[model samples]
Target: MQGILTQITALLGVTVGAALIAKFLRQPIIVAYIFAGIVAGPLFLNLVHGEREIFHIFSQLGVILLLFMIGLSLNFNYLRRIGKVAVAGGLAQVIFTGVIGMGILRAMGFAFMPALYLAVAITFSSTIIITKLLSDKKDTDSLYGRHTVGLMLVQDLVAVLLMVFLTAQGGSMTISSSLIRLALGGLVFIVGVTLLARYILPPILRRIADSKEFLFLFAIAWCFALAYAASRFGFSIEIGAVAAGLALGSSTYQPEISARITPLRDFFLIIFFVILGAEMSLAAASTVFLPSVILSLFILIGNPLILYVVYRLMKFSRRNSLMIGLTAAQVSEFGFVLLFIGRELGYVGESEIASFTMVALATIFVSSYLITHNGKIAGAVQNFLAKFSEENHPQREEKPPVYDAWVIGYHRIGWNIVQVLKEKKRSFAVIDFDPTVIEHLTKEGVPAYFLDVSDVGLLSELPLDRARLVISTIPDIQDQVTLLKHVRLHSAHTVIVANAPEAKFMRTLYEAGADYVMTPHLLGGKWIGHMISDGKASRAAFRKLKKEQQEEIRSGMPVQEL
Candidate 1:
């Protein structure tokens, strides 16, 4: 125990110093943790000692807490909204990556089972790392961020299912029986937890809500309890942690619980990264360096491309697709678990494990940098995409229609605006990437282009010179800025209205020459203030507001974070 304590102390000291340098150098803190591990592990100072198993147990806390917080962020409403997307995106991504990657590995001379296992492992991206980075940027509430989170959740679920089957193959259990048991156990587990979350915890939480200490303790206990309960049902503790958060996600105190637990998550996560780093040595890296580098390149580049294709097919904006896709460029913690399990089952050997370890370290390093600088990277790629698009598609020959007003996006607020425009009998057209919206509008004889806003050459063809007004409802600030500049440059008389998610961005829009900027929360607050201006809201007034909101909601797509 004393030796373990001393080892931990020394590791922490090295980690803190390395993390400070990483921060100072503007690198991701995760990178610093890995560097610290490499220095402290047997390859260097050899400060990582004591029970190795204990370190793994400790490192796993960071993974659990991160998942828990992600679950907390996924409020009930978002969960319902994301069900279809997550299922489709997650399954499609896995199948594509696994099959294609396995083929590539086979071509590279790996045996079938080893190739299949590695391919399976590569399909998972680190949910913990993604949530951490997104949280740091306060982008968890953004549309792409929401999509990425949903995708990661699907990946994690897939990983769990794969592990169960893989274990069954290695043990006495028949595959069919194992799957049957898993299905039943998982279903019961989910339903039971959902019931507890919906019915049991709310009242108890409400009662203890006032005491900060009590609430914090309850959150921790709830997280750990579910984590233990999850293992009994064949689910991973990470899943249980997420379930715990999902239960309380709808609570008013989610923000407080999340905030209080963040510091602990950070610390444990640092330890996790360091331990991952320490597992790699110069000898291990050198032995399988070529294959590791090849696989790492595939993960860093091909994973995002597959996801990019998925999002594009779903009619998301190219920029949005690329941004979210890049978040999947790293191998997940589950990938390591799968590889290690394969080693234990004798499906793989030390050489395979070492290669994958190098791949993990390499992919994590590059992908972290990619995620942190995704905006700039996506923008650069968007330009390349545009160049290819022009070479492939013919230039538009039809003269662009002239409209008095233009709606830049056709979802949520933009949908409402189109309704009002129709009521007023104003000549307006919608420009959006949503094929469904475009198809609907086209069927109604309203001009709507199924187009990406980032394609400048195409947008420039629009008759902005005759536009009386332009309203942009896209969520990306860069896209909004581009439209603002284009409209401002073309016609000074056009009154441009833009939407911002918050007040701070309103100023940026206004500075870019927006005549009126609508921020939903700000306007909602003002409307709310109007309601209570005469004192508490009357029952009649509340009912009227409710009806109006329902009617408004029915006018557009379902409510989403964007």
Candidate 2:
């Protein structure tokens, strides 16, 4: 116990020191944690030599909890909203990366099993890391950011499947029999959980939620219970934990559960990463330095290339394709876990693990900067990369049309604006990239064109100079800036209304020549406040408003759906 306490204290001290330095350097704390592990491992001060097993156990729990939180956020409805690109593009990137990576490893003289494991490792990009970067850059709602998140969720599902398959292979039964049993068991588990979530868990959670202490305790207990059941059924704890979270994913309490679990996950994950660093052999890594560099280069370049081709073929604009592609150019934290599992199973040796670890460190560190400065990076190479597109053309041509107003991005907020415009009987044009939206609007006799507003050349061709008003519902600052600049330059009298997700950007947009900037949060608060302060003062008026909202829902005319 004394030794364990000492180890924990030492680990925390080292982590804090490394984290502070990393923050100062503007580098990811993940890199610092791994580096701390290396400094404290057997190759250095050997601080964790006596408590390696404890660290290992903690790390395993970290993986389980991390995956559980990921599962909690994986909403089916949200996935459906992102459309087919997330699923199709995600799977395609995985297959291409794995197959091509395997070929590369095989050519480098690795045995088939080792090559396969390494290939699988390279195919995943870190959801936690990339999502953090995207969120920090305030681009999570941007076209590429949304798709990147959607793709990562799909990748998470695939990672779970791969983990299950690898676990089955390590079992005593014949590979085929084990796989069959695993599949059946997984199906049964999912069905049972789904039923419980739909019928049993809701009532139970509602009661627990009334007591904050019980709610937290029960959630942890439920996670472990599912994990134990999975172990009994010959599945891994990681899979079971994720399944547990997935069961609660549709629950109203999911966000609270996720919020409570994150700090715990972060605490344990530090141990996991530290152990990972401790286990790596610098000597072995040095021997494979050339190969690791080759693999790292492949991931940094090839992964993006694969996604770029996929996005281009799917008819996404060149800019969207390039940005989304850049987001995938790193190995995921799951890659490390997969390699660790392979080492435990004896499918890969220390050398192979070391090589992959080096690749992870290199790619993750570099990709952070790449994603942070993506705007400049894209601009620098946009012309060169445009060659990959099916056509090196500006956004589609627009026939000259006279309009009093132009709406860019005909979704969500724009939908409501379109209704108002129609009610006023105004001559307006709607520009959106979604073919379905365009086709529907056109069928309804609304003049709609398929165009991305971010394309300056294409946007310039639109007769913004003739319109009295131009409204942009697109929340990305870059796109808003482009529209504001073009409209200000070409049509000084046009009133430009723009939307921003956060208040901080409102001033920036306004300073960039926007006539008015709408911050949704502020507007939402005001709307709710008006209901309470005014509507609630008159019961009849409140009831009338409620009835209208209910009727709208009944008519399937919800603002979001539109």
Candidate 3:
């Protein structure tokens, strides 16, 4: 017992110290955790030698919470809106990668079943890493970010179903019976969450949430209950935790809950990654180093190429397609989970698991480097990759209509401005890359196309000179700067309105040549203040306008009450 406690203390001290150092160095913390793991694992100090099970349990919890947040981010309607390009691109990448990975594994002399498992493992992209990187780079609001995230959401949702199917295959049930059982399990899960969310949790949470301590305890209880329920039903605990988050996400309390739990998630996740590293068998890994490196390179190169090919075929501009493709170069954390489970199922031995882990480490490390140096990489390959583009298609010829205004991002703020533009008889059109938003606009007879403004080639295609006014509702300061620079080069006198969520970003946009910047909260207040000062009885009119606008806002939001 004393030894165990000592190990825990040493492990935390080293990891926390390393994490602080990494933070100061402006590097990814995952690298620090892995390094700390190597220092503390069997290969070195051996502080965390035998207590591997505890960390494993915590890691499972991380997976659950991660999946739950993923579910919350998903909007089923987005699939309907993506054009032939995104859908074709995503499907093509999945199929091509899965097949190629399997072939490579088989050629290297692995049996068919393990090869299949490895292939499926390689098909996943790390949603967490991608989200964190995109958010950090302030690229999350770009057209490529939106399209990439939507495609990832589909992959995750499909992965959940695949997990369900795989779990059943490993059970005692026959395939047909297992399918029936899986359907029943999902139905039960949905019903149970609805009952708990609609009837049981809200009132209790309301009272508990009034006290910070109680709210924290209740959240833990909620997470544990769902996890236990999932285990009892022959499902993964990760699936249950995700359901818990999804239920909470459906509530008005979601943002608050997410905020409160983020620190806890961060703390636990460090231990999880450390444990993952500590379990590695260096001697075993070395034997398979050649195979692992070979497979990792395939993932680093082939995966992104598949995405790029599909995007280009779908008619996306070179820049946007490239950006989206870059996000797929790494194997996901889910690949690690799948590899671990492969061991438990007796499909892979310790050496094979070590090989997969090495691949994870290599690809993740290299992918991070690639994403960080994306500008340099893009520039280097820009000319060579252009040869693959189907740029001569007939659809490129039709000229965009002459408009007085052009709006970027048609989801949140853009939607509201579009309504106003219509009311005022302003000749305006919107630029967006999301399939769903574009589809909705098309259905409403608005001139919308799947556009990626980050793509310099696509920007070159737009008739920006004809539009006297431009409004960019995207939140990325860098992308806004790029667009502003191009627009200035094309037409120096065009009036431009853009948005930023923060003062620093707003200032950056203004310096980049924005005529006016819309900080949503500040602008909303100013608009209401003007309405209140308009005339006698303006307060009453303002109240009515608020109700109508609020209703419209709620209706147009991507999130729906589930």
Candidate 4:
């Protein structure tokens, strides 16, 4: 216990020193953490040698917390809509990468089973690195971010299934029976977790939320309990922890729970990454290094290409597709964990695991840089990549024949404007990327679509020439700029309305040819002032507005009420 405490202190000191250096250099903190690990690990100063087991336990906790948070935020509806794309893309990448990796190994004179295991290790991207980097870039709210998150979830599901398959293969059961049991077990696990999230967990969290200390302890306890249960039931501990967190998501106390647990997650997660770095030393790197380099390049470049193709095929804009493509340019944490487990099962060797880990770390470092400077990178490559969307590419519907005014993003202001347009007998259609929103719009007999406005293909298909006005409620400056530029090119007379969160950026957008920029905050204040001026801020008037909102929602008109 004394030795462990001393080692932890040394580890933290090393980490803090490295973090300070990274901060000074204006680099991501993860680089510092890995460097710290290399410094303190047995290969170097050996400050954290005997305490490796303790760190590993914490590392596992970090993985659980990370997965749990991911599960908590998954949009089930969105998942269903992109289910086919996600599954097909994720599975294809896994199979293709695995096969290619294995083939390369066999061609190099390695045995079949070892080569197969090595390939499986290369098939996943690091979820931890990807998510952390995305968060750092504040891209979590963007379409690309959302889609990337969904893709990772799909990959996670695939990895879990693979784990189950591997487990079953090691057993005496027939293949068919094993498959059936795995399916049933997974179904039961998912349903149980869903039920726990939706019902049983809420009250427990509610009762304990008032106590910070208690909530922290409870979160840890719940994580361990679920992990233990999952392990006993032949499920991965990471899956169990995520399931546990997802189960708690239905609770109103989730935000509080998450807030309380974040620091703990971070601390443990640092240990996890550090431990990962420590485990990087392998004897057979002389043989595996070349193969690892080849596979890493394949993952970093090829995976994004596949995603780009899929998005293009789905009629998405080249810009969004490219941006989203850049997000998947590394193997996931699941890849590392899967490889580790496979190694433990004696299916994969330590050398293969190390090679894959090194590739993951290298690609992740590059991915972080790419994502951080994505805009600059995209701009640099835009002209060269333009050919990808050229003559051979299906032309975008740049003009709609019927609609006089097209509104994108039918939320609060958009819905109100739609009502006014209807009263004025203006022909209009709503276009949104959200399938649920599109479905609700359809139910209201309003022409709507699950199409991203930023997608070049979708833009090419749009009847922008017929539209007298186009109002976009999406507050992305880049998307707004792109839309405005396209509108000017396609229809000189079309009025383009876009949103900006800040007045300064709004002015910039207007100068860039936006007919008007809606600053939601400023507009809200103006509306509130107008209401006060007209004496419409009274209780009765407020009640009337509330009633109208409820009615609109009931009538399948999706509006932001709160």
Q: Which has the greatest TM-score?
A: 1
lDDT string for model 4 (1-562, tens) is 8999999998899899999998999987887887788788777888877667778889888887876665554445545766776676667666766676677778877677777776776667777777766766756546666667667766776776777677667777766776677677777777876677667775675566556678768877887788777766666776677677656654444545565666777888899777766666655667778877877787778767766777777666666667767877877666766667777778777777778767876787778777777767767877777875752444233222579898877775677788888889888888765445655566677877545555554475467766889998876788777778778887888888888888889777887688888898998899999999997899999999989878977764554534
Enumerate residue pairs that collide in model 3: 68-242, 81-435, 81-436
Alpha-carbon deviation at 57 in model 4, angstroms: 0.9
Give the residue spans of candidate 2 off by over 4 A: 80-87, 106-117, 126-172, 230-236, 315-324, 332-351, 371-384, 390-562
TM-score of each: 0.69, 0.62, 0.61, 0.65
TM accuracy, model 3: 0.61
Question: How does candidate 4 score on lDDT?
Answer: 0.72
Model 2 has an lDDT value of 0.79
Stretches off by above 4 angstroms in model 3 are 20-25, 69-91, 109-114, 127-171, 191-220, 227-235, 313-317, 333-351, 372-384, 390-562
Model 1 lDDT per residue over 49-147, tens place: 767888988898888888888888777787888789888999999999899889878988999888888889888888877888898776776777888
Candidate RMSDs in Å, in order, are: 13.2, 12.3, 11.4, 11.2
lDDT of 2 by residue, 1-562 (tens): 9999998899889888998999999887777887888888888878987777878889878777776765575555654667588899989999999999999999999999899999999999987667656755757646677788778867976886676677777776566776677778878877887788789987787566645567678888888888888776666676677678778876655656765676788798888777766766667776899989999999999998899888888777777787888887899878878988998988988878889888987887788777887778888987786564455433332245789999988775887788889989999988875546665687779988655566675565468878999998887898889889888988789999999988989888998889999888899899888878764647797688889878855643435644
C-alpha positional error of residue 4 in candidate 4 after TM-score superposition, expressed in Å: 0.9
* Candidate order by decreasing lDDT: 1, 2, 3, 4
Task: Please tell me which predicted candidate would have the highest lDDT against the true structure.
Answer: 1
Task: Note the clash tally of each candidate.
Answer: 0, 1, 3, 22
Question: What clash pairs does model 1 have?
Answer: none
Quote the lDDT for 535 in model 3.
62
